[model samples]
Target: MNDYAQYEKDCEAIRTTNQQLLTEFSAWLKTAGLAAGTIKNHCSNIAFYVNEFLLYEEAIEAKDGFTEVDAFLGYWFIKKAMWSSQASIKSNAASLKKFYTFLYEKGLIDKQALADLKEDIKDGMPLWLATLARYEDPDEEDVW
Candidate 1:
């Protein structure tokens, strides 16, 4: 096939894949009994990850770069928030990780990507504590 033809075919394949992903996501949301507003929120979160992080990485950082599942956890949850309080950050990370796991299981991305990403985050809390303890006395509950 000609180069133009090959490019067209590739574009078509990607469109089809995206359509399927959207359909599956909607079904999953329904089966999970998610409310419409919550489903919208989840879709927005996914779009944010794709547009802000994944697309930026692909466009500027590396031509072949796709989504880094771990980055979703770190960036969306840990970095995108107004506050970095431990409890909120942990909760956000858990939610984002769950979304990534869903995408992985759906075959939208490689499972190892999510697994390795989560593995990298295994020491997140402890690492944060090591840094926090450097400046604050952990013995005092009201210090922070």
Candidate 2:
């Protein structure tokens, strides 16, 4: 296969394992009493992180993903996703935080790292929003 096709195949292989964790994450959300729509959104958002961003990688642990989370929220999601805004960014970060919590509770991630990730989200929101704004620029500044 060609490069893109090969990459697609690799991503699919990774998702096969990641999907099991997602199922567990969904169950946890239900037990926590989240609405069905909210659960679906969380699962979908995390699936994007796992299936897209974590592609062609060996390790699939939460500890290895914090930097990926930063890139996803700070850049890729803003440029590629239709829902690009402060609220959407916050929502995505929240989804990832919940997912990481699930991983932590499952003993898949370091507790301290998870706590740090939460703080990073709280601290990084403004910067993420500014980066998104820069990405959305329509060249208005050059019109003068």
Candidate 3:
């Protein structure tokens, strides 16, 4: 197969794996006593992150997605997701933290990786929110 075909096959495999992980994550959320609606929201958020954003340009596995959170929240999500807003960004951040924590608990990621992901979310939230503000501002000179 050619490179593009190989990329497609790889992405399909990752997506298949992601579905099982999401199912387990959903159950974990339930065990934590989260409301059904909240669990649904979190699972949806993670599905978008792992399935769409992670697969958009490359077949990035969900376990490897901690490193992409910065770009996803700070730029790509704002530009790409039609539902992008302050509330949604905050919601997604929370979901990501929870998902990474789950991965860490399952030994899919190291402690340092989880720590770094949390730190990035904490440090980048203000800027990410500001970027959304600018992107949504009609009169902003440069929205890019």
Candidate with maximal lDDT: 3
Per-model lDDT: 0.52, 0.79, 0.96
lDDT value for model 2: 0.79
lDDT over C-alpha atoms for residue 117 of model 1: 52
TM-score between candidate 3 and the true structure: 0.98
lDDT of 1 at 48: 49
Ranked candidates (TM-score, high to low): 3, 2, 1
Locate the minimum summed-lDDT window of 10 residues in model 3: 135-144
Better of 1 and 3 by lDDT: 3
Number of the top TM-score candidate: 3
How well does candidate 1 score on lDDT at residue 30?
69
**Residue 105 CA error for candidate 3 (Å)?**
0.4
> Between 1 and 2, whose lDDT is larger?
2
After superposition of all CA atoms, the RMSD between model 2 and the true structure is 3.8
- Please identify model 1 stretches exceeding 4 Å from their true place: 1-20, 59-92, 125-144
lDDT of 3 by residue, 45-138 (tens): 9999999999999999999999999899999999999999999999999999999999999999999999999999999999999989999989
TM of each candidate vs. truth: 0.49, 0.82, 0.98
- lDDT per residue for candidate 2 within 1-144, as digits (tens), equals 887777667666667778898999999999999999999999998887887666634334434686577767887788778877888898899999999999889887887979888888888788888887777788645311
